[model samples]
Target: MRFSSTVAFPLAANLLPPLASAIRISPAPNGALLLRDSYDYIVVGAGIGGLVVANRLTEDPSVSVLVIEAGDLDDRGEDVSIPGSVGFEDPRRYEVKLTMTEQEFLDNKTRTVSQGKAVGGGTIVNGLVWTRGSTANFDAWERLGNPGWGWSGLLPYFRKSETYSTRDHDISACKIPVPVHPVNGKHGDQGPVEVGYPNYYYNQSDNFLDGVQQLGIPVNEDPNSGNATGATVVPSSMTQKNQSRSDARTAYLDPALGRDNLHLVTNHTVTHILHNSSGNAIASRDTPIVNVTGVEFASNVTGTMMNVTCDKEVILAAGAILSPVLLQISGIGPAQHLKDLGVNVAVDLPGVGSNFQDHPTLQPVYKYTAPDVFSVQDIVGATRDAVREEYLANRTGPWTTPMVNAVAFPALSWVTDNFRELLDEAVNTTSNLPSSYDSTLRAGYAAQKNETLCFLSRTDTPTYELMSTSWGQLAVSAMQPFSRGTVLARSSSIFDNTQPIVDPRYCSNSIDCKLLLLGIKFNDHLIATSPMAALMPVPPPGFGTADARNETSLDETMRAMITTGFHFSGTTSMLPQNLGGVVDPSLRVYGTANLRVVDAGVIPLLPGAHTQATVYAIAEKAADIIKAGSSDAFPGAKS
Candidate 1:
């Protein structure tokens, strides 16, 4: 049922257009051609979601699919492809170089929020850990008016998106209690995306796991299964040979290069969606849900404006920040905001850019002063050169293994004492949110708070995610944060180079601050355990651990230390319109006929796991939904 094979594309495309014009080609068959043309579907943003949807929809040779990517191919060289290049930061790879408005809680400091600008999106420059959330996470989607979006409904598509592989040798030989499923047939084997465990495991990785076991957390062999609790060795989207990154470019796009039915236009920024007149027909109470005719775009290099039409639909997969920005500029946002910005209202959909959620993380670096292990700094001069030579020769060395190899998911009760009472107090108070929110948004936040309490009560699901990365750092993140922020266009024009204002509202919610502190306490306990204590861990050699004896000190230290987990969602939520949602169960924008959002933005809630795994599954399911509704989609498609 998977369309991962490139062979299927040509066989199917033979029934319609010639091979040359099947996908994307410059210097048209004729002398000249206008960039503004029509296609059955025009997908904006070439992220994983957009790529997956385009690949599946293009299975129909009769139906043309065009993917317009704002960023160029990630030709960033070795820094992007190699594993050890993680700690290095490169600003050119990101599309949205945003800084949040000074936070009221985080010492009034503005934190930078970046998004991937490459053709493969964040996959090109993200930590490639692969894991899924608990069953309760997806079931919550069903509870929020999105029927058939629970774990059971989505697992099939999860398996459909990637080819899962395990290590050849017994991973148990490491003597670490970490359970690993070597070759489970339940996982995908023939999909384009490669999902596998690392071939090389660090010496300290086993020690880290042992430390977690000493802390009384169970060891899970596989977190990909529904109930994701306990410590486990995480799988990643990596190649089996070189153990290098396997991103959206390698997954869905490269295979279908010869597909003339699929067109990829790179280095073009999508400015705004073009809509047709609704005439006298009212879409709702006082708004018009006008049909999206096309999208206006401009070349990144030349800055030449262009227009492209769609016969069927315009899909927006422009991530959380940009997607909402696009909607706002196109007049499908808050009526008052649009009016203030001098844009004609398409729909007074109040929920276009509200409910922004992310995994706010705090990384506490510990100095590894133990013997028999080498940190990134230990391999200096000659040793570093030798290691680099070995890696370049075979692509299998210390550099081949990513710093993030293992993770632990701990329940709140396991991490903190009297967690229930602490949670109840947090839930009862309205200080978790700003008091001036609109009535609909406030109701949405209230519903989210209830759902979060329900999540906290589940022992099988963990509220906090803990990980040890780069040999000397402990990453403690509040996986299910109660804080909801906003993404707003800096100006009325979509052409404005100024990035959208992204406010994650990190630690703004009292519950979120409490959870983060609990996570920090949990990490401290882990390092202080017998096995880890013998390692003689210090605070990055110079800096000392926060003296969080009191609430004020803890709050102040956390404000200075907090950063993003890079998992942003819920800007364009999937709840019903009445609940301040932008998209419906089918991912279609509430009031638009031919516009749908198929990115992390539509995720109404943040799952306990990383956003990578769930996003691929969501995209796969979205493709199925679009295919079932299309007359010319593949055969034997589910409706």
Candidate 2:
């Protein structure tokens, strides 16, 4: 089946009535006009986190907020809104040119890393899966010295950010059968973001669910209810009526656009964070720590520079990559590395771009030969007229769904017989630490290893996630990998347009490799088992060529095929300063008084789920934290 690189469907233009009427946006002003313009708050990026903080902080009519986004407003265009479309390929819609450095473990190959350059950020180009990590995942954050960040503490914000809508039509309409639970989940119904299921379900969904159950994995009542183990059909961030993609723009930014206090500056890239300094502007260890004052930005189109000051605070929500890069170039990274780049070191924090983590994923395809079953191939491979008819007649069709409807999170025990031995090796082995790792990074990894080993027996603390799509693909990923990577600025110039050196160091740790191998072996077993085998499954056209019957054969395929999950985080981790943490528990930088990083960058560790939902919850909680003046105002806030 061949998919078009560009589909001509402007789904965002058809946002349901009330949501469209709420926005009041305008283009950014000229860079020359703002020499010393100031506001109550300055948000660096207009992604999900930045937008959420901007909207909430502007709630008080007196406080003025400015959001400077590198990309323009994507008005639900064809690439941004349509599912399974090549939105990530559109340079205007996403940062398609971003490439990571050659990973040493993945056969020294450079991986293409796609980040949303548009206003909505990654939410504009992702698969639209709305899922939260396991309870153990969040609890690990609090255990790592971040107070009030466990599952229970963040649940309210999760509920507050979403407006749940049940699927109105019957599942039988899509020729798929599964037990329905309309109210078993704990989701909000009054928030701005829409959460619901697609009108169409692939016929393979039931087979995938049954295959996992046959493996002794229990069915989860609700994947979002703190426990994400078992086979489940996860909901997505989309509207129920036409299944329009509900991104940060529709949920958080649009609703707050009418506020007179909020100002959005599109097509502006934040170059560096400005701090109070003197004498040749050379920052060193002896330099006294001062509060962040403002930021300098460059016009995306014309390259003109401008400075915008803030009276209260400067929030960095430029996501995992840019957020850390901003700090590094702004003289807030490792002292030695900064000096090499000719950047003044404002704070000699070694953890600015360290502790980088991401999910290493691979596709294990299985060709199911069932005449009665309908696959995504039948949709995308169909005549253009047929797809167009279904879409134009009713917005809910194969063209609207991203084909990733069902997902499974399986524990190590469910996959391998020697779970105990694997856990011991994973927890005890510290030699896997890369040569670049310093004493501080090693200590941080030690803490993470201990916490992960503590949850070895818990089924909910899954080490890997298996997401099934209608395209005969099993997307397997090691969720809570111990392997750490680093993202550093190659040059001092932020606009040198030089891609940062992103080395995920996939499979660097033996335990991570072992766990990923287990996940691949589990998929092989599931496909060869009863319910799935009934469909006469065969190896996907080109993949699984070598026999996947054993770990040895599968390990080779895993190494050659493993790719980035696009869930980059942990660069600017939120932990204690002594534990190699850049940001404190309050989401504040340790040295700066009024600077905070409220994006995926602050996630101390990678969770066992997709990053979209957790990013929203983090923003919601950040709003309340910023409003109350301190993290201690919250119930779970640590001293």
Cα RMSDs of all predictions?
A: 6.4, 3.6
**Per-model TM values vs. the true structure:** 0.90, 0.91
Model 1 lDDT-worst window of ten: 1-10
Best-fitting candidate, measured by TM-score?
2
lDDT per residue (tens digit) for residues 462-554 in model 2: 777888877578888887788888888888878864488778888877677778877877877788768788777777533453566555656
Question: What stretches of model 1 exceed 4 Å from their correct place?
Answer: 1-36, 93-96, 170-177, 182-186, 278-288, 300-302, 431-436, 540-546, 630-639
Q: In model 2, where do residues sit more than 4 Å from their true spots?
A: 1-36, 84-92, 169-172, 175-177, 180-185, 278-288, 380-383, 540-546, 549-553, 635-639
State the weakest 10-residue window (summed lDDT) of model 2.
Answer: 279-288
Candidate 1 global CA lDDT score: 0.75
Quote model 2's TM-score.
0.91
lDDT by residue (1-639, candidate 1, tens digit) is 000111100011211212223355453565233353799999999999999999888878888888988777665355566665554435555445677878876778887766778878988877788878888998988887787788878877788887887776653233333768633534777777888766556676777888999888888887888878888888888877666678887688877778778888876788889997443222342242588999988765356567889998999999988899898888888777777778777777777778989988877778778776676555457886776666667665566666687789998887767987987877775545544356777777777778888889887788888887645688888888888788878777776735677788887777788788777767677778877776778863213445645656766777677877889899889887767888877788866777889999999888998887888888888887887773123222232
Query: What residue pairs clash in candidate 2, if any at all?
Result: 12-76
